[model samples]
Target: MIDVRAVNYTLQVAGRPLHILKNVSLQTKPSEVVAIVGPSGSGKTSLLMLLAGLERVTSGSLAVNGADLTALGEDDLARFRRHTMGIVFQSFHLIPSLSAIDNVGLALEIAAPELSQSQVREQASAALAAVGLAERLEHRPTALSGGEQQRVGLARAMVANPPLLLADEPTGNLDQKTGAMVIELMFNLARERGTAVVLITHDAALAARADRVLTMTQGELVEAAVTH
Candidate 1:
């Protein structure tokens, strides 16, 4: 679950404050899929970053899974992200040197340090298999196609089964067909795990598939409509 209220984000640009987001409020419950659709520079990704605790808001309250993200210290924020959230990036942020299995296992290792190596591998393997990538577990990012790489990224995000998933343009880099496959997998997996999803995308049809659709303009959350 996520709760954000009147959040504002600002940046220093040439010694002046640059406002990136304004008066943003959002709420999501378990197993709910919320899609944010907006033009470039409308602060959709900025909102996602705020939800992930990657960026501190300038003002207002933000909470995920009942943890006050605005109140957490840097170390606590990092821990919260590891334990409570999963993120899928548009760029498929994978470690090139590590195999797919290792990349996925690393998430579990970080979140649950008590897990043994074999346990990590077993869970990681199961995650990749869930994404239909059991055969590519040993391959590095460079060895996989764009779609395959994104699937690996998905496995990495979902391996720990966090309660909330933040995905920014998850299918932006793939072909239409591959993107559809990845999106379907993402929705199905989230539903199966009862994970709340906050998706940032530009695709209207894709946004329409969510339980709710939100539109942002000029750093403001201007519209919210239930789509399903």
Candidate 2:
């Protein structure tokens, strides 16, 4: 679940404030898939960052999974994200030096410190296997194809079973076929887990697949259409 009300985000550029998000309000329910389609610099990704607590809102309110993101301190925000949010980025954002399994396990180790090494490995293996990466668990990022690497990234994000998933151009770097596979995997996994998803993408057809489609322009959420 996510709730945002008239949220405004401003960034400092050359000592002057540049408005990024203006009067943005949105909500997502559990197991609901909402897609945000917008041009570059329209604040779609900024909104996702705000929802993830990676950036603080300049005004108004923002909450995800019942936590007031604007009110949390840095440490609390980090902890909240580790426990309640799963984010996938277009760039994959995998550590080059870490194996696929290690990368996924790191998330568990951070979020659930009480888990033993065997437990972490077991869970990470399962996550990777779910993404069709069981055979590549020990391979590093360089050893995998773009799709495989993205799958690994997906595995890492979902390893914690977070209630909310935020994806920013998740399929931007892959070929159409591979991107489709990744998107299907993402949606299916989210459905199975009842996770609320806020997806930021440029693909219209992809956006149309969501339960709702929202369009952003000039830092404002200008249109919202229910697709199903």
Candidate 3:
């Protein structure tokens, strides 16, 4: 679950303060998918970064799965990210040298350090299979197609079964057909696993598929009509 209250993010550009997010607030329950649709520079990605603890919130609070993200120290944020949240970026972010399985298992190996190598392998393999990438487990990112690489990224994000998933324009880099496939796979798998998802996307159709939709404009967030 996620609870963000009146969050504001400000940045220093040159000499004046630039407000990136203003009074943004939203809540999500287990297994729910919340999509954020916004124009460029509307603060959607910044909100996701804040949720992932990659950026600090200048005002208000962010609580994800019962952890007060604003109050967490640097080391604590890293540990929390490893164990409690999963993030999928616009870029796949897979290592060039690591195989798909290793890329997926790396997070698990860190979050569940007590698990044996075999156990980690087993979990990662299951996650890859769930994302329809079982046969590509041994392939590196460069060897796979765009969709396959994104599937590997999804597997990596889901392998640890974190409580919440944050995705920022996950399909932005792929073709329309490939992007649709990735979106469907992500939503179906997250729903099946009972994981809450916060998706940042510009595609209206994709945003419509979520349980709730929020629109961002000029750094403010407002509830958009749910189409379906």
Cα TM-score per model: 0.98, 0.97, 0.98
Q: Give me the runs in candidate 2 sitting further than 4 Å from their true place.
A: none
Residue pairs of candidate 2 with colliding backbone atoms: none
**Best-first order by TM-score:** 3, 1, 2
Per-residue lDDT of 32-111 in model 2, one digit per residue for the tens? 89999989988898888899898899999998999899889999999999999889999999999999999999988998
Residue runs of model 1 more than 4 Å from their true location after superposition:
none
- Go through the candidates in order and give each one's C-alpha lDDT: 0.92, 0.92, 0.92
Worst 10 residues of 2 by lDDT: 219-228
Candidate 3: lDDT over CA atoms? 0.92
lDDT of 3 at 88: 89
lDDT of 2 at 132: 93
Quality of model 1 by C-alpha lDDT: 0.92
Stronger candidate by TM-score (2 vs 3): 3
Evaluated at residue 55, the lDDT of candidate 1 is 91
